[model samples]
Target: MKQQSEMILIGGGLIGLSLAVELKLRGATVTVLSRNQQEAAGLVAAGMLAPQAEQIPSGPMLDLCLRSRALYNDWTRKLEEMTGLETGYWPCGILAPVYERPDCTTLPQTPETPSYWLERDAILHQQPGLGNDVVGGWWFPQDAQVDNRRGLIKTLQTAAQELGVTIIEGITVEKIVTSPDQKVTEVQTNQGIFRADHYILTTGAWSGELLSIPVYPRKGQMLSVRVPDDFKSLPLQQVLFGSNIYIVPRRDGLIVIGATSEPVGFTTGLTPQGVETLLSDAIRLYPILKEFPIQEFWWGFRPETPDLFPILGPSSWDNLTLAVGHYRNGILLAPVTAQLIANWVLNAQTDPLLHHFRSDRFQTLR
Candidate 1:
């Protein structure tokens, strides 16, 4: 019998934990080193799996997102079955409201899931609580969301652990010890040295700290609110994409409002200005939001690359794989990212999907 491939994954965010689950299910001995789960961006994400609503242009990034969005249903279902925890996979669709008449040509409409423009009256009927400023909107029926904070992140962690994936939290990775032959021999962490046959860097936002990758932190501030018990249903039934903010309604009466994308490096804490801006914008998009009580205020760092695409596939080291720089789509892209990376690790099959996201794309820029 062939010996199982031993893999050590750095980072235990949604991306890391998802990949760990995939690898372990494929019969690999997987160990994940998580610096801090609370600091992980996944825990703080709004978990909007919106490819069309995000208006990503037709390209590799869009393709990657669409593929991952397609995989979310089965992925979350299997995780739910395995862990008996609901991931809050709500395929309630997304509504991108606009104040002015939107130019149809500029819209990112794909054949897989076409977005239709809803006139003022039609949009108002869809969402009665929408602010008067919303003249019209594009309705992406296929776009959906998951509850990251309350559902997906915890479910993924549980599923990973249940599948025999060893997760060691609070251990910060100090460095990757590589052999002279350009292969990772072991990883040096605050806990100790851990050797593995292969290593994966899923360290979002901090990928550059460990290696020469272009991944960096893009800080975002977000908050959630709870609907009053008197309401018959959620004030907002669908995810509302406003000009500068988005309002996501949860099944459990908690509504998520977010975010401000500041290129502030690793700087933490939610600013008063950030919270104010989000609240004002959210209220403008959905006037009824003013009645909701603020539940939480938080922020997280998105692992962003220079070109705004993920840095995936093999690194310069033979045994090291790069799977960072997911930016705002970390939760949306977790399923597909795990599948692609696991295939490469277990079968050495490099799918053509990884062509655009290769780590070598930044070689010239570096």
Candidate 2:
């Protein structure tokens, strides 16, 4: 008989949903179980799709990012075609202003790209309210973003429904029960029994509670302020880069300012200090943002790995796969992750990305 076709995935966030979409497209039956809280986080994240603009220096992490960036165009197209969701994916560009002298240190100008290193006059012309004090900056027209909140939820719910993939809500996965041979036989859930041939854990920050994968919660605080309709220029067309913090604008006039990367041990609270820091920094970068009224103040935890990249592929166990600890790049890396995992589920040996991120790295941990 052919290999069993049912693939059960835990965590209904972008990663889980994207994987379901990929697998369903390839004719595999997929089921996604998402706890309410995990589903909500996807409804709140800022979906930045910039790898070159967001990659931090050098490492295996940067390589994963660049590869993911290359895959996004094709991935988004399929999702849009299948689900008919726009996904708000824009590859327009990113603007990194250099107002403070330290701004250059954070997001350095790429001399290779002449369009970067924008003069103050040009920045003002391109973005009218860019704090006239700015001197120069970098511009990346290829970096992109999506309205992550809408894109994720719509994709998950719609894709699952349209593609005949099952989505069970309010089902919190307890653990992956493995056999003596290191094969996952079943997933224990708060609701009931779920048996599967292959189990994937993509629970983000919560993955640590279920699996000892070295994934931790890195607290990130965000501010959503509602800008006035009559406000001067499009305060944000590109994901704005700045000295300390950055801003992302949505179609509904809600601009997001973020974030503080605090390892607060899974505490997702709304803090005054966090709010002040994001708001204050946003104004420093774009004086026009100061004119907006504050709307939402909140914080959440990002699933962080020591290597700052997701661990994919089969777990130490035979049938359990790990897909957590994406840290800051979860949204950016979702498309490629889905493709890689979907391939792993089918081919079992052809996924090079799987071998690259396996937990065997922990054996060399020092």
Give all TM-scores, in the order shown: 0.96, 0.89
lDDT minimum window of 10 residues, candidate 1: 1-10
Give, for candidate 2, the lowest lDDT window spanning 10 residues. 105-114
Deviation from native of the Cα of residue 185 in model 1, angstroms: 1.7
* Maximum-lDDT candidate: 1
Per-residue lDDT of 1-366 in model 1, one digit per residue for the tens?
112238889999989999999999999999898998776779767889998999888888998999999999999999999999999999999999999985662565658798888899999999887888888999999999999998998899899888888898898889888888999887777787888888999999999999988888888999999999998976778899889899999999999999888888989898989989999999999998898889999898988889999988999999899899998899999999999999998899998989899988878666
TM-score (C-alpha) between model 2 and the true structure: 0.89
Clashing pairs in 1: none
lDDT by residue (128-203, candidate 2, tens digit) is: 7777668877777867777776565575568768989888888888777777887887777887778877788888
